[model samples]
Target: METPTAPGPDVPRRSLISGSAAMAAAGGLVLGAGAATAAAAAMAPNGASGVVQGARNGDERHPFYGEHQAGISTPPQDHLVFTAFDVTATTPVELQLVLAKWSAAMAELTNGRPVGKVQPARANGVPGDTGEAADMGPHGLTLTLGFGPSLFDGRFGLEKFKPAGFDQLPAMAGESLDPAMTGGDLCIQACANDPQVAYHAVRNLARMARTSVRTRWTVLGFGRASAGANQITPRNLLGFKDGTRNIKTEEDFAEHVWVGDEAGQGWMAGGSYLVARKIHMMIETWDEDPINDQQGIFGRTKQAGAPLSGTREHDVPDFHAAAPGGGPVIPADSHIALAAHENNGGTKILRRGYNFTDGLDAVGRLDAGLMFLSFQRDPEQFVALQRKLGSSDRLNEYIRHVGSGVYAVPGGLPAAGNYYGKEFFPG
Candidate 1:
């Protein structure tokens, strides 16, 4: 195992949670909570959206092939805690095709009726789709299914999660007309159906998405490896970068995602758990701003990653240091201000976001942003943070929420027989 090395003065932690720290961390506890919000990048001069989507993996594609932080090792072979596909579309039939091969299919969002108090898939008591129902294949399939720990978690025996799987596939970048555009029916934005992937298993679905004729919404999903030959380290679209500002895995479920607690019921557990929002960035707008203005909004420098009115990116803002009597130096409305409680541990969520950039725009537009997707324990925790940002924050001015929806991320699968969200939310 390699030793952890905290990156130099500018980089984040590069070491291990040795001794008590490691023990506490292993058991699911975080000490100090530092935050790193987006800082404005220097305007691209010519006014181009600097954002760019990562291309298909050109190197080896497998769970075991990639390298991760030292000491934090995977099995002799690589695996995932789970794999999921959030495909989008209209026409119940179109969505049906994707689920045709699966053991069960659940229409999660049909014209706006949230899967009411989700129960076991069997409770719907609709006859199985195997024999008499097998004909449903004619209609396409819609899915929010996934591969869980049983299918991805490396440590299944003692952990609260288990089951993992492996497969690779194709995908692309594109969309279709949704009622959301004309307000006819709901438009689908499947991250599972986007144009980013390393290998080929899920590509089959992407190909299907592009070809499907009946759907109103287009697909914008990406297939990640649940198991097998595909690699993804904890980094943003930037190759050498790792989103260290994020919470740990254990903290992921317990904090952000829904788990049986005094607040909610058990069915919500292994069921959420919850889906975060789809925050889109107006890359063009962001790319056109001056660095000084950018720094003002984020309170940080792009290169040094330091706060405008402060020291380093992780340095606690000396909110009171400057004026014995303070007045908006850090801008109470800034993104940093709203996300401030994250430092106090008041409310935290596991942010597993992705960076995507579509090509260029006609009038030099930039269609790219970080897919601000996160899993949460409750929608309110996230909303509260947003409430702080209010409806009109500096960040919001440059970002547009083109798509929005939620899903109950499923549990782990034991084998290939049939796995997805169906098993997690038992009827």
Candidate 2:
């Protein structure tokens, strides 16, 4: 396979350095040629300092600094380990320090380098970095951080800065939310092509924040990519193509996913709101159902993933099309129909969801499902679409919303700051 290069302009020779030189500067750790190639490709377009490099393994790397966070718009990775934490800090200063450490560490890890200065094994007095991922490349890791509504409840004098739409999501119909799995004061979304790399990113961050925050919930997820030859769309646990009509281009992202300056609070100008739902699939029950019924639940053909009214997977569904008996071919209550943008007043969310199987439940059935990650300009967009699904989606019979969280993900780090959420900290 061809090696992936950073997407954009080339860097000047004056600012460029050899692979060995870069690694030596980054704590004397030796990196493979692939990692070196990624580092070289990530140089700033104008040859400015502080360019965030891509990961090793020839996987793409997203820049850590920009107007918006990387993972939100960066193409979705193959594996995800989403985590939420409850902040234990009493003052703004303490919270600021945590963000500083996390921001610095994130930049390094995403570049396929260890956190802080790497010490020799013999000098190990509380080593700065965990060595689990020492050999593993970055594997296209992207770490996204967000603040939950509860984080602004006057804890650090941030209640006044909370965005108007940032609040605890209202209880939607048909939800069996578990307290243990729901809500958090902060959230970190780690996505990578390798599961071990993804886990390592979150593990090290959690360790760094051990004193100021505690893990509230975590969900490990993997995606089933299309196989060779005929396979086309990625399948969910329910054995249907997922995210067929997802937002993809920059035009759609600007319209649907990214928050604008005029949208609300100044701090959230280019940021986006994230909605995470741990949807539990009743695998055994669904598997026992007939093929026709299974297809009916999602309103798409099982094998081809085309709408009932259309033959091709990418063909738009004629919602008004009729069947032999004059009924709507794509049923009104079908999963696709209810969640369609046209049905929801032109609203759409960028979905970067993943499939997960966590062994079995209390009854010995597969505890498999989708860790649904949706990024939108406003939280109300998710609310509107979800309310429709909860009340009428046919797929609801086979799934339950057990875990949910909404977070305000801020824009990317500024050119000078070395901390996440530094704008929120008082001078």
Q: Candidate 2, residues 282-337: lDDT per residue as tens digits?
A: 88889899998888788889989999999988899888899899789988899988
Q: lDDT scores for all predictions?
A: 0.32, 0.75
lDDT of 1 at 156: 16
Model 1, 204-228: lDDT tens per residue? Answer: 2333233232232232323221111
Cα shift from native, residue 134, model 2 (Å): 1.2
Q: RMSD to the native, candidate 1?
A: 20.3
TM-score of every model versus the real structure: 0.48, 0.85
Best by lDDT: 2
Counting only residues 3 or more apart in sequence or on different chains, how many pairs clash (N, Cα, C under 3 Å) in candidate 2? 0
